[model samples]
Target: MSEVRLYSKADFSECRLTNHPLYSYIQVFFSQELSELVENSTNGTCYALEVGQKLCLVVVAQFQEGQTYPTSLRAQYLDYAQEELALTGIKGKRLLSGAFQLLKRIVPKTIDEVVYVGNYLLSTNLFQPFTTEELQKIEALLQRRFPTKTIVYRSQNSCLNQQLMENLSALNYQSFISRQVFIAHQSQVIQQKKTFKKDRKLAKDTTFNIRTNFDVTNYSERIIELYTQLYISKYSQINPRYTPAFIEAMKTVQNTSFTGVFDEENLIGVTMSWELDGTLTVPILGYDLSYPKESGIYRLLTYYTLLRVNDEQLFHMSSGVGPFKLSRGAEYFPEYIYYKRPASAKERRLSFWLLQKVNTILTRMSNKRAY
Candidate 1:
């Protein structure tokens, strides 16, 4: 087995290479310069397995402690919990909170720690081809490296690595379905949906200028304000929080581009996307929620994205709306967060059992509602 070594903040530069064609996105994040840019947020540690000086496998993990969950994960959990409680009366809310307390009892408070492998916000992880034995060896190394904390790997857009998945399963990693990502590809063949048609009609009447580059620093304050209004106040359960500092940092990221939707001098909407390897990944979309839905900004943006796809002849386009993507002739993949802990860890074992029990109850309730 190849030796696996841990690299500190200073040694991440060793992993940076010219290009691997298939893994440019992975390469960009693993580079020392980019890693330093994100260090304040990610707090990551890099690891690599080498075979005779050749890098065979690499893993980057973020260390998180109590109340130190990433801004995105904490926001999603709190928002979703609050949204669910809103439907119930005071008594129901109390009961649900009690249920959460019971769950917390099963999990050790000291172990609310996790090491997230991959892009903590976007759920993308990369690994070079390695044998099953090598994968197992890497897993063991991770366990030894972080003996007290749980390890999590998030896979999104159905980009699953067979070898890594198998190795994780062999090590008894438990999986939980998170959400879905919507991807539109080869969209020139897609038939326009009702939303598309409605937006086309509205676009003729509404005049908004779309530009690829606008002064991010000048509008940085307003951009964060609008983003909070739309994301936090409105769609509260969404993952990822775009603070002014984070957005400003993202503007400097090499692969990303910023697009502004303007009504004369006023900025109405904005999107930040990455164009990588024939794929366009839109990570942020902030807009004026006061605008009437009939104004068709949502559909107009979708239309604009597909237009770019057709013009560039790109292979993939990813949007945040999962259900609407299907209507736009796109495929949706359910995302998952996989977790692993030492087999002897009591908290992990009990939590897994509780999860299975809760899943069964939820399934029964869903089936009854359907009938």
Candidate 2:
């Protein structure tokens, strides 16, 4: 018999599944302190789910109008929509713009209420698989709990979660490509890619210092500042606005590591990565962009991270920088979001069907582009 348990913020510490195999990994995101910190910073409310002995986190987010980044469906979908348009050509953008203007009001509000299963508040979500029977029960539980919200499972790629994706599809969840992500084996890149070698040498010979021993708790503010500078100010404000409290909580998490890049004692770059099941995923990475492009700050940060991956481990570099990641022997694949809506919500079903159609076109366009 499979058992499912849900823990809210107030009672998370009471969960008895601490002895579970993935508890250490779960603690990185779902520990009571960390969960509270994340909720305080973002629009998300966190919960812990335990099925049998496997554990994962869930975030129920109510996106407000004009919400920035991934917190809002409009922001998340638009970012990928723009990328797809860019790859196809300007003509596609003009056509899509008019269509978007026509549907903008209806689409955004329809996708606003979301229940993110396995949402770790990171670029990628690492999941411990649930059996089909277990998942069916879990799905029913979520539908009952969040009757009006769209249930979503994100950051799923076939390479990493083929069985899980199959299970979701079997349960009648709709899936669409969210974005292109890169996955590479460290040793193969080190041996085959000349560009990777050059970047490694550049990082090794650079005047800036790399420090893994620095106390992240002490520099939480600086870390958030650098992260905001790149992820929000330069890229898009739609990205999750993580706070210093979130960084400070990371200091005590096991199986996670933080690295800082410094130029003459000033913190210029920082990355926080965690390893699970022989895969290293760097969900938090940022650096000062005020320096000239010739300064090679970004290159140095990328190479330094590559060096941290073990020879046998795979690196899951989250979306964007397609050309840069591809040049270093990373293979690109589409990451997907699997979702389902309540049967009674006819309008939401229609909205999601429309979204599926739009995503299908975008996926086809993205697939045609050379990496």
Candidate 3:
């Protein structure tokens, strides 16, 4: 077991989580400057797990109150709550479940809440497996530190952390299948290059140009604008509303790139991606809605992204949009959300029931979409 210690604001810069390549995004999220931006909503705190004074693991936690769940979670409890309100008899059980879900979403001051952990902006797998005993100790340490709050360890990932999964199950944490991710096998996409010739030709036919950014200042506003028009304005409920501050923070992360598609200088599309362990992943994507869909702009962007993988000889390109990714030869990966509310028996029971109902509602929704 390692000794876990919390870093105070003064010495927080020393926490190694900030520089770890595997968790650079985590580092950016918990960065002093960015943390200040989100402080009103969440109190960002960092902890180091050290074995014999050598840092072994680092976890950044956000103590949030009256805050909704992390944006990574796509499930909308409000809609389910509204639907549940309209049901009756056996179906009315959804209403009970919805009520609890709603309550959990807008946690009041009574039970201090740590609603989620991990990257809030997208589905990320940063946590290394921790033993059951270590997890138990971590939970106890978190409880003691935030005595008032009922910490709910929230994790969303396409790939399962087997040990964490086992430990959560052993500890009686409720689990829910939140969503799915799409992975495009590089060899598969490359082998089918003949099929993409039309797309490549279309992209070349148009005078549109694509560019990548390390310092995003020049197009940050436009990126946010297009992102807002396509995602925030269109899908505010489910989208992760990234601000310019977040875009600016990307400047500090070494492994990330912001690629933009422009038509004679107008920024029409943007994709924020990270390359790690030979996998290129796109976490944020947006495009101008006013652009003529007939221009084949989005498809062009996809083609260019595939080129990135082909050029790098990377394994695969992982993206979102499950159906679209599948249509484009990308395989699907199931993503799950593991949550545990271990404060009291009542809280645990509510959470368990809520998890079941949420899963049911979400599965039904997914099936309808897939069908």
Highest lDDT against the true fold, candidate: 2
Candidate 2 on 1-371: residue-level lDDT in tens? Answer: 88888778677788887766456555656554542554323556678888877788887778665454445566677543553455444346777665555456566565758888887777787777767899898888888888888888988887788999999999899887778788876565554688888887787788989898997988898998898898777776556667787787666666678989899889999989877667788877888888888778788777776775666677888877788888877778888899887765656555556666777776886687634
Instruction: Write one digit per residue (lDDT tens) for candidate 3, span 237-274.
Output: 33445567777777567677777788877888888876
**What's the CA RMSD for each of the models?**
5.6, 2.8, 5.5
lDDT of 1: 0.54
lDDT-wise, the better of 1 and 3 is 3
Ranking by TM-score: 2, 3, 1
lDDT to native, each model: 0.54, 0.74, 0.55
TM accuracy, model 1:
0.71
- The CA lDDT at 298 in model 2 is 80
User: Hey, what RMSD does candidate 3 come out at?
Assistant: 5.5
Clashes of 3: 1
Q: How close is candidate 3 to the true structure, as a TM-score?
A: 0.73
Candidate 3 pairs with clashing backbones: 112-149
| CA error at residue 131 for candidate 1, angstroms | 6.2
TM-score winner between candidates 2 and 3? 2
Q: For candidate 3, what is the lDDT?
A: 0.55
